[model samples]
Target: MSHHIVEVKDLHYTYPDGTAALGGVGFRITHGESVALIGANGAGKSTLLLHLNGCLIPEAGTVRMGDFPLTKKTLPHVRQTVGMVFQDPDDQLFMPTVYDDVAFGPLNLGLPPDEIEDRVMEALATVGAAHLRNRPPYRLSGGEKRAVAIASVLSMGPSILIMDEPSSNLDPKARRQLIHLLKSFEHTMIIATHDLDMVLDVCGRTMILKGGHIAADGPTEEILQNEPLLHACSLEKPLRLQGCPVCNPVRA
Candidate 1:
């Protein structure tokens, strides 16, 4: 049997404003797999991610993490297992100091003081941001803030990492650094973003969302190569890589 980490079945969600965020969307993610959720603005990628961590309960259908289903009683457990990183780091990091922000989750879980310290240090190191531990979050640059946000979730030692637009508002250098950090993580990851290049580099599979539903799902290379489908969904086609003639011979 396949070891699946996340499963969503016919999930549907609508906001209080009566906006349908997710419309009968469904998908399953196997343990250790890196998947990307790609879509245009208002495609419901964030809404779908919120369901994974129980931040938004589905009006219909269900979201399951491991063997536990997301419900009122199971939200805490589900959240502990699934760490969510929002598009804007400011929304996630609110503590006065970077250390406190990074240590918040483990502290809330009631870990020992020593253990919390260790977790905070480890998480910061993982994101290459340990040097900024004592600094205030507001003092950091956009990329640094993003790293701090990720460290906060990492402190919880979550098995699955769910990120929404991780590459947004980042410079080229920062974007590359973020990609390197993400690639180093062994945890299962589900990223929702419009960065097709990042998706091709970090994710093996891609799921395109449209009108709150999954419009296409397949291997990253194959899906990105389909120009018509990509254009229809308001997504850009993937860039092709050039190869040396000696390394990649053309067919006769």
Candidate 2:
């Protein structure tokens, strides 16, 4: 499964506006690992994710997806191997109908009509969105739209799944459903989100970014439970790990 491994060494990037996004960030994610990237806003989580799929090339350093280095020549193959789901479902659901949106990637790959149909159906089914295939994307709820967006990526048959704020805007029930769905996927997943509680449930490892650099990386529970470290990075313990107000009321 070396083809599923993702590695970054001395990764660095800066926007045209002179804003540094990543500062010598480096890590290795082996096949089938579910990892979470958590940090406050402007912490470089999204920037790091974008580089994994060749969305934004690093100004310096190197990114290797599987055995091939990330370059213009290898970009197509890297993109095919790494599937990215943007923070907003609307960004991915531009096609008129859910089916069309899900089939977009496969269609771009030049898949035959019958194979495209099969991939579309299978992808929708995998995300439990098959019943909504005929509906227009704008008509679906936030959770429904998120499902279809994920289906679109799955249709491309990617080995690595990278998601940005996937549970944002979802209701409690929808969020729970999303968590369950994430748990079921066997793909190598890298999720960047502020939902530390959800990370506790879905990811085994966590990396905290601060000021465009990684401040902490370790097992999820261990990293999240470190209150001082989290505080310094503008984070808090996952609510699940905090003492309940009802059980341990504060005295002022």
Best-fitting candidate, scored by TM-score: 2
Local accuracy of candidate 1 as per-residue lDDT tens digits, 61-107: 98998768989998888888889999889999999999999989998
Per-prediction TM-score, please?
Answer: 0.93, 0.98
What does the lDDT come to for candidate 2?
0.93
RMSD of each: 4.3, 1.1
lDDT per residue as tens, model 2, 89-207: 98889999999999899998999999999999999999899999899999999999999999999999999999999999999999999999999999999999999999999999999
Which pairs clash in the backbone of model 1?
A: none
lDDT of each: 0.91, 0.93
lDDT score of residue 167 within candidate 2: 94
Candidate 2 minimal-lDDT segment of 10 residues: 243-252
